[model samples]
Every structure is written in C-alpha cells, then in structure tokens.
Target: MNKSRFWVVGGEYTSTDFETLIQGTERVVGPFETRGDAERTWRVLSEDHRPQAQVRFTIAHEHLTMNA
Candidate 1:
C-alpha cells in the first residue's frame, strides 16, 4: 500500500533567479495529510514573506509505502 503526503518547502534565496537558497534559511513545513492543508500554510508563509522578493515557498507531494 501507499499513501500520499504533502509538504511546504522553501525559504530565503540567494537571488531573484532562485537558483540557490541562503545557508541556514531552508525551511520544510511538513507532511500534511492533504494538499489543502499545505496550501493554507503556504499561503500564510508566502503572504508573511511577501515583502521579500527573494523569498518563496511551494508545495511538494510525495508518495510513501505503507506496510501492513
């Protein structure tokens, strides 16, 4: 069996191009059960960091194997 998980990943980047993230600025929000939950959190984080043009965040989805 398998289960889907969601996460919010990102933080301050080194530049506007967003090729690299600044040291110690990387952030991982979590393994949310649903995309909606992750999106809500993403919205808040994005809004809070809206003033920083170099800061960005996005939702990442992963599939995990579940053992019975």
Candidate 2:
C-alpha cells in the first residue's frame, strides 16, 4: 500500500509569521497525513525556533513511510 505522507517545511524569520514558501534558512520536518497535521507540527517547530520574531511554515506532500 502507498504510505506516502505530507510534510511541513519553511524558514526562520525574525520579522513576521507569514508564508515564506522556500526562503530563509531551510528547515524540513514531517510526514503528516494532512496539511492541518503538518501545520500543527509547525507550531512545535516555531517554538523550537524561538529567539526569532517571525516564522513561516509550509506543507509539502511528498514523503513515503518506511517499513522495516
């Protein structure tokens, strides 16, 4: 079965919380089932990226689950 999932990737911006797509320092994380899921994940990422004023998060659907 296809186990591909979506992901959330963005950059660290100390300006505003907006859509930066593929800009600034690159950061990728996730294999979420839905965009909303990824967005939730982004929150954690944003917090981890603290010290910055603004942060951007994006959803990317192109990851496959690995089975062992």
Candidate 3:
C-alpha cells in the first residue's frame, strides 16, 4: 500500500525585509490530506494572529510511504 503524506509550511516577513525572506518562520499547521485542509488552517492563523510580519502558507512537500 502507498500512503500520501503532505506537509504545510509557513513563514513570516515584513515589507521592510521582503527581499531577505520568502516565507514565515512559524509553522501554522500541517500534515493535512488536502490543500483545502491547509488553507483552512492558514485562514484561522491569518485571523488569529496579526503579527508585524506577513504570513505565507504553502504545500511544502509530499512524502510517499510504502507499506507491506
């Protein structure tokens, strides 16, 4: 059997330092099954935290697990 493992990654950066960073340092929430799931989490974080840096969420990577 093959299992799909997806991950979500986030990072923070402000306009003053936009060139230095592309994403947020904070991991909002992850390991969800689908993009929608990650998006939902990102939404919550966006609403809950109003940090000096902007938050960005993306599907970082996917891992394939094989089971015998």
RMSD of each: 0.9, 5.4, 3.9
Residue pairs that clash (backbone atoms under 3 angstroms), model 1: none
Computed on alpha carbons, the lDDT of every model, listed in order, comes to 0.97, 0.71, 0.61
How close is every model to the real structure, measured as TM-score?
0.93, 0.47, 0.52
The digit string of per-residue lDDT tens for model 3 on 1-68 reads: 76565566656655544444454365746688876776777677666655644555556557677867
How many residue pairs in model 1 have overlapping backbones?
0
Query: Candidate 1 lDDT (Cα, whole model)?
Result: 0.97
Q: For residues 4-44, what per-residue lDDT tens digits would candidate 1 score against the true structure?
A: 99999999999999999999999999989999999999999
Q: Give the TM-score of candidate 1.
A: 0.93
Report the CA-based lDDT of candidate 2 relative to the real structure. 0.71
Model 3 CA deviation exceeding 4 Å by range: 14-24, 48-53
What range of 10 consecutive residues in model 3 has the weakest lDDT sum?
Answer: 15-24
Winning model by TM-score = 1
Q: Which candidate is the best by lDDT?
A: 1
Q: Rank the candidates by TM-score, best first.
A: 1, 3, 2
Off by over 4 Å in 2: 1-4, 13-24, 61-68
Q: Count the backbone clashes (under 3 Å) in each candidate.
A: 0, 0, 5
